[model samples]
Target: MRFPWGPGDVADLPTVGAGVDTLSDLSRSAEPPGVRLRTARAQARAFRAEFALTGTPDTVVTCDLVTLPYPTRFGLFRASRAIAPFLSITNRMLVIRWRDSDGRPRVLLFEPSDVELGRYTPYFDNLARKTPGVLERRMVREHGTVLGHLARLGIRPDDVDYLMFDHLHTQDLRRWLGTTAHQDDLDARPRAAFPRAKVVVQRDELAGMAELHPLQRPWYQPDTYRDVPPEAFLPIDGSIVLGPGVAVVKTPGHVFGNQSLVVNTSTGIWVSSENVIAAEALTPEHSRLPGIAKWARGWQQEVVLNANTIETTADQYNSAVLEKTLADRSQADPRFLQFFPSSELTGAWTNPGTTPTFSHGHITHGVQPV
Candidate 1:
């Protein structure tokens, strides 16, 4: 599909292959799981080499959105029982400044998690009911708003030309993109978060929100899109290249429309998504955390998922492999992979056995335009 703004026709750009483009392709593929994974890995390596040749983005920054208590079982894919019941997951917002192919500057915001509406998600709603203000009290907001961050960078809301997310889970689109219908719950009319930005999301993910399956219902807030105008979204199938060194590729299994942001930087290529909550989870064999390596070795699993639901477990596993393949090895710690989780697991006294052996605290590359 051609974007009305920003970079034009993604179809005209290069691709790894049609087979690895979409989740449906991977799901219905006739090739065996191992065979498909190996093949995709090989392709990704070649693609990574080619991607490295592209110019790096002007600036890339990750800001804290909000940190909340998350289930330990799901975070580690039930690999351990010794960890705290809940671990803190700091959801982040990644902002990138880059020059389009035409050499015009552009801004892209990835994973702008709406803290307010996020609490209303079924899973959090249930947690809130069990203990009122407990979830609220535990929530951390040390980092300011996305708008505030943009202002510090001298970017107006209208200056943002593109917006994206790893997936649509827990996001409330009504506020991000103004709705045509009135929102009685808000008790006020909501305007677009970034007046001119076009939301680039997976086409399938948007459809999944229309009628969520029982398993997906808990993690998603579909009603958030109830009144959002269709024109506000730029739904594309499979993988797409937004500009130099920036791509959003389908990374299915976490959810139907799940995708990951890949950006080529001076340090190397960095991938962002919630496929794995911790860096050690990617290189499980070398994990220092309790039960991770043992579980991976016992199951012969190469990667541990940030598992919530397992309906698409295998697909999610393959997608994580794809991410590992695409990302460059970390310079700080070669043992740990360069896959940065959108919601990274932070080690604190409150949550034991959840500390990551290696953490890429935040990425800072180049300078945002003044």
Candidate 2:
């Protein structure tokens, strides 16, 4: 199939290829924001071990699996699984990790769980209400598969040092609330399973979240928001550095406070935690339908704060252009690869052959075995 966006259209821009060679240059670029070293070797070993387990040593990693779901529509005329003539749901998490020059490790994480509705039959109940059921099942299956694979790789849970929450969506909040409410309930079992690592969120993001929705104020734990000391926050025009090696760039048009993480890994600069668009959306050749573009843009604004800030202007413009270009194409016309970093790649033992590799723009070689 001819992709709406493909090579030759924007030859000057980078083309993401396979293996370490493609990643070499980009990896060597300036490190990402929010990373500083107090302990070097300890961090390096942790990073290397995590990369070996996850399989994405230099790029973003997405958790969960993509699969078909039942269709329906909920409030605001949105298509829910119940409304779909047929439906499918695919969910995943965004993961990032890096190893310092000496092999110390740093990690970043994002939540990508969503109940996608399709096929149009118009179910009466709100689709969001039913989404948890679908998501719960998917998470259970995915978590089991991921854990088993990691265990075989000799990676234990304690190895992780950072867990970034991209944003707390309704689904995520629901899961947390449910878990806290019934810590012992069998159905609520998933709540107690968060990774035992430092849970991090942007200080401004946490504050904005509280201001936007008062009710949610109680949802977050007091300790969840750790403001990077003033010295740690970088103030670039389009981006803000959170720490020594970690920078959070505003990539709006997806969600308010939608940001991306730039980290320095052993390989090079890894742009992980992108929230402006899906992995395919960033590729020069792909395009999105007009309706989807409008919906996505609107959704981002409605969900996040400071939606119109200048930081996201470029991303917003680019995403809008792509959406218009592919307005006529069906969703399947585009090969959508969800964005992920090197950390979550650890869950790929189930399909050893199809596993992804990391590289800078020049390399197209296959990934090295962990």
Candidate 3:
């Protein structure tokens, strides 16, 4: 149907190959957001130099970096008005692309700006007010450019086959679930926007959310409304196989049903959504520990399932055990020193000493980076 951004001509973009890696590296560096501006400039210089040396002036390649500000409430102890009129949060999105194995084109979308801004609205808002830096502005500018580039790539609103939502923020969930009674209704037509795709989710995790909190009951409708039984939603014990090319892993502790997708691109690329914020407590790498410990602490009781009891019912008891283990590990691990150094359980923004950062598609076992 001739999408907006030349869909079939991915090779024309010179920076496509290194786009994802560059974004990841930029995000992971220890430099303060202010200093990162210079780092970004240096990166652009290097890319230009490499391209020039290669004599690829006619490459016609472009890279779009974006930082989107998600309007949200602020304050840890004090809650903001239900609907604040002003924008008050910050987050980012990184998109990259390549041709798939079947020679069909593909794009990679990562690090949702909305989700991050929702989760840490207060912190980001404070940072923005106190020190407005180049890094922050650059992130916002890049995010806008990326969106424009996507439009150019022919990625029409309709061509998006998969929405692949990692985890819904409370506000986002309310907005989404409030729109329709049946989850399937939301999956169809103009509302669905993205079509011909299964909205994959972790079966056990979905069930757990309904059991844990009364407020989350509405959000659990996606798995419950299906004609099939609970087991039908659960394709695997640890991971839910959605289809031949996609799978959902149980990345608990971010939200009860927070799951991540393992997507096999047509071009031989295996990408994990890595629901970093939603599943922050499941990450094995110590370096990735979030500064705020409370975020992990809040979801710990709701998400973790015991490894020993995983085989028993694969439901209730296992969840209890997982939560206990996370609480224990967070206390004993030195890596969580910044967040939970003294084994003190603090607010939702404070870390409480846990190993394995949880997020969508991030499980402690059987996760091999691609």
Candidate 4:
């Protein structure tokens, strides 16, 4: 099948051109004057329209999963820090393909990361200093880089159409978004992995990173995207449909501007987020939350905060509940609520095969591949 992105190899994928160029220029700022208020309102309304539609995808969308190995602290995934102290998690990125609103083949990549890159590996850098030999040990057992993992699944650096991170924690977007206006290739700096892809990020999320709060600054690696040109991003406020069955919704809790992607797969509506590590942990009740989430009740705790708890404790609780409501509840026997963890953290303890392996479907044709 041909794609409107262009014919032949993905290198031919067109840039976000003149027709859609206004997208990059659109401001999602929420200041005193709010110059872009009308545009922001239009986005909000578009999201509401899609939210109300509530139906299966217009086309059978498919998502190909690849988990790039990364070390994770056990204290983060669960509320209990006493049990397992650390875990082996992968930075899971999904390449979702479907027909867009324009009836053309489209692709969306979620949580793109190459931890081996100097900018993206600051977390490991800290670990090396604090624990010593920790990163080296993990690297020895690690699988491969993000690009390498994608290649194993038949995707290359140029294959991606859109790059979206759940939240930029320890990410170096320049590695994927490509560096802009840099003339010297000999500068020893990395370029964008997906030159044809436009980055999808929340307005506030990008703004917050420009000058991060000391609390959440540890996980952030701003050097990655600090120099990125404004035109490379497609910033949005609230939720809006990206294509037929895919939408990025605002589900802030893990971070102030955190978001989640909702996809209508063959199984059901699958949501990818960093709000909660595992779907099982989000034990739902009759219109209420259970387990550790209930403990956060009075404080409005819904699910255990993943890592960057920030000042959104109550917000995280509410967002967790909201995420649960969006999950597919078609199963009863250890319910397979189509909720996916953006990080490989869950695979470490819950299911190992999913660590650097696939959880479902195929890259070419997902669940109902023909």
Candidate 5:
């Protein structure tokens, strides 16, 4: 299932055609925000009904990466005036096994690396420096590493065909891709985690690593890539289908090159991103969380963003709409849509007033090869 395109090339990648482009174009166009949003929803409905009927992946597992406290304001888009300053969240990695249209099995690791290095980001760094109990009590890893998960599942490093993150925030690529020059910052000599895998990231995110805006600088750890080779990245534009039941589409506004992972499962379709922290966000009207429904109703807004950085607020709003339109309603709770936030808000007694109305917990489908 090897892609024909080389590093930094998407020439041979299977694209989603005009549907993805139309949604993105409408976001950036001068059309009224309401008009564009409505149009985007219609387009997404058509896109899903017409193009998202691909076969389900052979297996899909959500691997817990880490658990940490994030600002509640950012998690709920500052819409809530809740007393809690921070919300507990679990950052997860998706290990997906699927066959391409040619019937070749492929292994993809989505959001599988460098979450521990998030402490170096300015926002988290400042919190660690100033907060009393954060470094000791709040930041904890109760789960295994990505490599360990793969090993237990009988997957070798080289067995991975592709790697990706929804966006570049808090990622340090040196460990995953390896560095050509020695990096004093890394604890050990950096080497490739998946020797044969290419990072399938968006072109804009790849470029932003080198030239970050003032607002973007806090979220990215660009120094990690200072010594990494250019050939380690396979940058793509817009949306692309990686294999049956799996696609990555641009969902900008949270970051310049933000994307969301869309997949078909035995139950239905699911969309994953940091766009919305809770499943209730896509259907805030059904939410019982304080200030969430009130805020949305007061403002006449349908979607609430995970606005750690709102580079493009309108685009972010529209992206959430697109995600909602693309996903299937949850089978467990029909009130919620199956849009899983990459880092989801979890219930923690220590973090009050931040419990999500509904948490999908994790997605598991099919048996893995022994």
Candidate 6:
């Protein structure tokens, strides 16, 4: 719970206010707002960890570094704002260039988006959820610090071995898997932004994040796995297959191990997840996607568990009706199929290209680094 942001935790604000010039950082206070997960024997033991979509995916490459512009809350997702009051979600910090069934070179990063992992108004300030500065000036005019957004795709952070996440809400992972208590004090701790990465989660989400159920620990940062050990954690109790098209689709009820990643691109089979918000909310036909599906009426489509962490509405509606095949029918630009969402993408930010749903390119000026 102690995570405000640095290499994974480094704060130094206080420059002044209309953007305040700077400082005034104050962070991590929302440790309560749960929706489900108390017992049905822990929802039938997280509904026996299921995963679908097999074979036909031995090719890929993709990068959509950043596209954030958020607002229109149903607490932040469930198709937020329904039809507008401002909404633009696209925090796509991705990078995948696959091959590994012995084919090697599997450099990956499922959810790389983190501009100093923006505090997002102390996580909805316990739901008063309003905006005067507009998500802190679009997160300081739009993010940077994900190790310099992976050095603008030229890649680094130990050339990234594998770092996945479809859950671990305001994530931190000790900066990137480098805290075996104190790796012989490498300059004062918190290091490993990638260092040959190996962080594949979902052993029932590290046992439901070691029992953090006080209403899902305010979207959790769980001190970024605090002392991070136990062989640095590779734990997978459901969907496996890390290469030859890359797979990680546990698809649990959004939190007790919510996984989704099935890259096999050229515009096909690209399923990544923040738990089905758009892609038409994985079609049961008509959820054109918008928030407060509270419990979705009439023909029941609101599997809206926007990280509602443990609701288990029929296991998040069978993981949003099997996340419409994570990606296998192809189409990344217009028809909106490659289902990607680690954050910032609820409805083309403001009806830009207008279709079923759309987001494109992803890169915006200045470019800072440290």
Top-lDDT structure, candidate number? 5
Deviation from native of the Cα of residue 130 in model 6, angstroms:
40
lDDT of each: 0.79, 0.32, 0.30, 0.54, 0.80, 0.50
lDDT of 2 by residue, 1-370 (tens): 1111222322222211111211111111254321211122233333333333323344344445343332212111231112223223234444444555567765444443322311111221244345677553542233423344334434454554444444443323222122223323234434322244444443344334434344333322322212212121111222333333444433333334444544433343344332322233333233232233354455542211112123333343432232222122222233432223211312122222212122121111123114
Per-model TM values vs. the true structure: 0.91, 0.41, 0.33, 0.69, 0.91, 0.30
Off by over 4 Å in 1: 1-24, 132-136, 139-142
Per-residue alpha-carbon lDDT of candidate 1 for residues 1-370, written as tens digits (9 for 90 to 100): 2112222332332223123332234755788888878766876787788777767888998888787788899899867654488877888898898887778888899987667777898998888788656545755444667777778778888888888999877887677788776789998679887888888887677666666689988888767776776677777777766777888888888987788999998889999999999877889998888898999999999999988876588888988998998888899999987788999988767788777788888888887556
Between candidates 2 and 5, which one is better according to TM-score? 5
Error of 2 at 295 (Å): 13
* Model 4, runs deviating above 4 Å: 1-78, 118-122, 134-141, 152-159, 181-186, 284-302, 330-336, 346-370
Model 4 is weakest, by summed lDDT over 10 consecutive residues, at: 1-10
lDDT of 4 by residue, 1-370 (tens): 1111211222322223112121212223334323443443454344434454544444333332333234333323334322334544444667676765567766677776655554335555666566536644543344455676566556666766788888877776665665555524227455766777888776677667666677776787765554555566776665667766677777665777788877765556677787766554455221122223334444443455566445455455555555666666534333435567775343444223223222322212264323
Instruction: Write one digit per residue (lDDT tens) for candidate 5, span 188-215.
Output: 6777888888888877666565567888
Looking at model 6, residue 173 earns an lDDT score of 67
Q: After superposition, how far is residue 226 of candidate 4 from its true place, in Å?
A: 3.0
Q: How many clashes (backbone N, Cα, C below 3 Å) per candidate? A: 0, 65, 48, 4, 0, 20
Write the number of the candidate with greater lDDT, choosing between 4 and 5.
5
Error of 1 at 6 (Å): 26
Question: Pairing residues by index, what is the TM-score of model 2?
Answer: 0.41
lDDT for model 3 comes to: 0.30
Clashes counted in candidate 3 amount to 48
